[model samples]
Target: MTGHTKAHTMVGKSSQSLPKRILHSGVILYVALAFLALIYIMPFIIQVATSFKTDADATANPVSLIPQVWTTAAYSKLFLNSDFPVWFKNSFIVTIVVTVGRVFFDSLAGYALSRLQFRGRDIIFAMLVAVMSVPMVVLLIPKFLIIKSLGIYDSYAGMILPLLIDASGVFIMKNFFESIPRSVEEQAMIDRAGTFRIFWQIVLPMARPALVTISILSFQGSWNELSHFIVSTQSSSLTTLTKGVASLASGQLSSGNQYPVKLAAAVVMTIPVAVLFFIFQKRIMNSSEGSVKE
Candidate 1:
């Protein structure tokens, strides 16, 4: 009876302390994370505040959290004088096409690698892994050479085709494909469905999470890509937001330092990605969760 009483007393004590310990740990973690978040967000906060300041104010108090004198001259110049509209259009067009192309092509290739049986399959997979590891910066000159030789320079093809199939997207799709149970495909095969039909109809629908991941990555990458667009095209017609903003930053249009114009451009360029993030946020979260579960 004493032993039972002692065991029950210890269990009661532990139960009472568990909540307190968890609460203490949670508070400590929250404080640390909040501090880090503030540190990271401070620069962007300053950029936004300073963007509203006049040229004189901006120059004198660059680090000020609030503008002494606010002005809309920068935004007016961006809209009225610059080719910001053209840059925005190019970014939108390229981002959409690249995102769709990558999702479809990469997923197809990945599905083939995961399921298809043919000679040289293992070799192809190994080559893809090797290709993915190759540094992107190193390929800049080579890609330029290829684009020039193909006679596609200054054309949309030069900009789009080279980025249509990325190795990282292929890898992500392959991983997601592998996570799926083989029995699903086995049943489809028993039905004597064509391989492409089974892959397109059955497998692709189940790959929404991986597809969203590839789409987001591709959109962001192509939208923010400056160097590739620089090498691929010379005309202002094809200049993307990144390239145009870079030119604005380096004083292409303005003779002197224009903090408001540059900061507004930066903020404008960030809006599309921000919208994409929020729109697909739930899907992204669920996708990550599903990946973890797998």
Candidate 2:
């Protein structure tokens, strides 16, 4: 009886401590996450703040959250007296086309690899996996050579064509499609519906999460792409924001520690990507919803 009482007492003690332990752990976890968030957001905050400051204020107080003097000279210059608008137009054109093309083409390729049975499908899939492993730097020269040979160099075709599909995107879509119940497609097959019809009407709707995910990635990737643009084009008229912003950051146009002008351009460049991510954050990696019986 005495031993049982002592054992019960120990259990009671542990139970009492559990809440305290949980509270301590929660506090620690929140503190760590908050610290990390601050680190990540600090640079962006500084960029926005400095964008409103003059060159003198930016240089003197590089990390200041509040500018000593706020003015829109940098923004006015970027909008009014520069080729920044043209660069943005090019970026939007390339980004929109690349995002749409990647989603459509990658979906087709991924569906084929996942659902269709063919003799050499396995070999093609393997080759795709291998391509993903190859560093993009190694392919840069080859990409340039191919673009030049195709006679699309120094043009939008060269900029947008090579980026329409990626191995990782294909892999993502294939895996997602395979997870969807095969019975869904079997029903369409019984109805004498074609493969394209089934994919377009039924399968695509269910794969919303994957589609949104890849579209975000493709948009951001193409928007920020530099090396490809560097190799593909030379005309100033065809310059994208990535190339133009790079020049801004490098002080190619603005001279002598003009941090506000540089950072202002960077700030503007990030707005589209930031908005895209927030709008789609809820759909990212969500479980695919479909009706399938056990």
Candidate 3:
């Protein structure tokens, strides 16, 4: 009886200590995470601070967290004198069209591949995998050739058409479809719904996280796309933000080292993605967590 009582007392002591050990571990983890987060965010902090500095101040205080003398000269030139607005508009248009197209077309293709019973589905999937394996840079010349041959060079069609379908988006949608239980789709089919109807009204609506992923990725890609636009269109009026910014970077239209203008352009280019990110922060976080597991 005495030994049993001592053993029970020891068990009680361990149980009481368990929560304290967990709490201590959690505190250490929190501190480590905070340190890592600061390291990751420090660059953006530096970029924002440096963007406000004058050319001399920026150059002198390369790593300073605060600018010595703040100025807006670069931004003024970018907006008022330069063609930044045209480039901004072009970027906006391309991003919107590409995001919408990829979401719709990619989901459609993914759904068909996942759930449909059709001839050549396996062949189509194999081709898609092969196509996805082809490096994007290698296709630059071929895409330009196709755009030129189609007589859409230097136009919006050339800018938008080749980007309408993306392999990554298709892959994301396909994986998301597979995650969902097949019973939901089967029930819809039992109710005599057409495949397109079932996919549109049923499965797609359940794929909010994947849809957000596709939208964000597509928007970022199309907005920041440089090389494709460089080869697709040659006219200044048709120049997207990426191409225009490259010209600015290489001293095409500006005379001096306009660091402020370039930084402001970078900041402006980042806003849309930033807004979308904040708007869908939860979904983005969940999607990120999900992808990490894969």
Candidate 4:
């Protein structure tokens, strides 16, 4: 009887301590995540703060997150006194066209590769996979050569056409299509729907998550593309935000280092991409959840 009573007392002590242990662990985890988040976000925060600082103050206190004297000179210069609007216009046009083209072409190729069984289909897919493995830097020279040979160099067509079909986007869509039930397409076929009809009306709508993913990726890639723009076009009017900002950083706009203007340009360039991601984040999460369930 005494031993049983002692055992029960120890069990009570363990139960009482369990909540405290859990609370301690939760606190530690929260702190760790908070620190990590801060670390990742600190650079962006500094960029914004520095954008509001005067050029002299920004250079003087480069490491400081808080500005000594806030000013809108950087913004005024970018919007009022520079070629920023033209750069922004070029970026927007290229990004929009590229995103739309990629979504449509990638989906088409993906569906064909995933569902069709033509001769040499395997060979074609293998080639695509191999192409994806090739680094973008390795293709820069070849890309330039091809753009020149095609007589589209130093033009908008040179910039937009080459990036329209991404191998990775095609791969992503193909994989997503394969996960969908074959019966879905088979049933549409039985209803006498044409291949294009089924793909466009039925399968495409069902693949919203994948489409959104590709759209976001294409938009971001084309918006931030610098090397391609550099090789394809030489005109200042054709320059995108990335190239224009790079010039700004290299002292094109001023004699001394204009840190505020450069940082402001950086911050503005980030807003479009950030907004795009946030808008599609829910769709991405939902698609992930659906994939998990499937």
Candidate 5:
């Protein structure tokens, strides 16, 4: 009886300590995560601070998160005295059109590759994989030549069209579509729904996660694209944010470092992409939940 009582007491103590152990572990994990988050976020914080600083202050205290003297001179110059607005407009146009086109065309191609069994289907997929393996830098000359040959050089079409379809986006969608049960489509067929109707109503709607992923990537890629825009456009009126910012960073504007102005441009360029990621973050999280449930 005494031994059993002692054993029960020990068990009770262990049970009582379990919650404390778990709480301690949770605190440690949270601390580690917070530290890592700060590390990643420090650069942006410094950028924002630097943007509000004068050129000399920024250069002097480059790593400082708190500016000694804050000013909006950089922003004022960007908005009023420079071509930033034109660059913003061009980026907006190209990003929107390219994102929409990529979502639609990529989904279409993915569906065809995933569901439709036709002759040379494997060959076509192989070709797509091979194309994806090739470095994008190698295609720069070819792309420029094609744009020049087509007489679309130095135009919005030149900037937007080349980025409309992405091999990776198609691959993502195709893999996603393949993960979906064929019985879902078979049931739609049993109801006598046409292929296009089924794809539009059922498959596409179910592919919300993949579509959102593609949309985010497409928008970010097209917005930050520099090389394509450089080779495609020579006209200042057609300059996108990346090119405009590059020129600013490279001393197109008067003189030394210009850290304040350059950092301001970097911060501004990051906002849209950051907003996009936050907006879709919930959906992205839920996508994982959905995959697990499936």
Candidate 6:
């Protein structure tokens, strides 16, 4: 009887301790995640803080969050006293065009690959996957030569056309389209709907999440692009935000380091894409969800 009582007491102790152990583990996990989140966001926080600081303060206390003298000189210079507006206009134009084109083209290509029967479909997809593996840097010279040879260098066409559709965008669309059930299309076909009609009326509507995801990625990619702009265009009038901000980095438009101005430009460059990401954050992740409806 004494031994049995002791065993029961030990069992009771373990049962009581289990909840405490789980709580302890949960606390540690949350702490680690919070710490990592803080580290990741620190640079963006610093950029925003430095944008409001005076040039001297930015240079001296570069890492500090608090500005010794907060001023709007940097923002004022960019908005009123510089070509920042022109750069913004150019980037907006290009980003809009590219985003729209990529979504339309990617969706079409993705649907074709997912649903349409063709002879070289597999080979084409394999080539696209292979192209994705090749570094963009390696293709810079060839891209520049082609743009020049096509007589579109230093023009908006050169900048926007080549970036209209990408392999990854097509790949993403294809995967999402595949997740959709064929019964949907088969029913449409029984109703005497044409292929294009079925795709437009049914498949595309069901792909709202993936389409939004494509728009976000395309907008962000085109907005942040620099190298392609460098190799494709040269005129100051055609400068995008990425190229203009890069010029700021090299002190081309300022006397001193002007960290504030540079960071301010960087901040402005970030806002649109950040807003887009936050707006569609949920949809971007599970874009292919519910594709196979019962």
Local distance difference test, per candidate?
0.87, 0.92, 0.83, 0.91, 0.90, 0.93
State every prediction's TM-score relative to the real structure: 0.88, 0.91, 0.84, 0.91, 0.88, 0.92
Where model 3 places Cα greater than 4 Å from the true spot, the runs are 1-24, 285-294
Model 5 stretches with alpha carbons more than 4 Å out: 1-24, 285-294
* lDDT of candidate 5 over 147-249, digit per residue (tens): 9999999999999889989999999889888877787777789999988898899888888889988999899999899999989999999999999999998
Ranked by lDDT, the better of candidates 2 and 4 is 2
Any residue pairs clashing in model 4, and if so which?
A: none
Task: Please report the candidate that would top TM-score against the real structure.
Answer: 6
Order of candidate numbers by TM-score, starting with the best: 6, 2, 4, 5, 1, 3
In candidate 3, what are the lDDT values of residues 1-294, reduced to their tens digit? 999999999999999999899788798789889999999988777777767878787767777988877777767778899999999999988889988999899999899888888999899888889998998899998888899999999999999998999987888888788777777777778889998898889888878888888888898889889989988999989988888888877878666666667767777877888888888767852434323222
Candidate 4 segments exceeding 4 Å error: 1-25, 285-294
Runs in model 1 with CA error above 4 Å?
Answer: 1-23, 285-294
Q: State in Å the error of residue 206, model 1.
A: 0.6
Q: Ten residues in a row with the worst lDDT in model 5?
A: 285-294
Lowest lDDT 10-residue stretch of candidate 4: 285-294
Quick one: how many clashes does candidate 5 have?
0
Across residues 3-112, which tens digit of lDDT does each residue of candidate 6 receive? 99999999999999998997887987898899999999999999999999998899899989999988989999999988999999999999999999999999999999
Instruction: Give me candidate 1's TM-score against the actual structure.
Output: 0.88
**Model 3: lDDT to the true structure:** 0.83
lDDT of candidate 2 over 80-103, digit per residue (tens)? 877899999999999999999999
Q: Sum up the clashes in candidate 6.
A: 0
User: Candidate 1 lDDT, tens digit per residue, 1-294?
Assistant: 999999999999999999899788798789889999999989888888877888888888998988887787777888889999998988888888998999999999999999888999999989999998888888899999999999999988998999899998998888888877777777789989999999899888888888888888898899989888888999999888999999988889867778888998888888789799889876762444333231
Candidate 2 clashing pairs? none
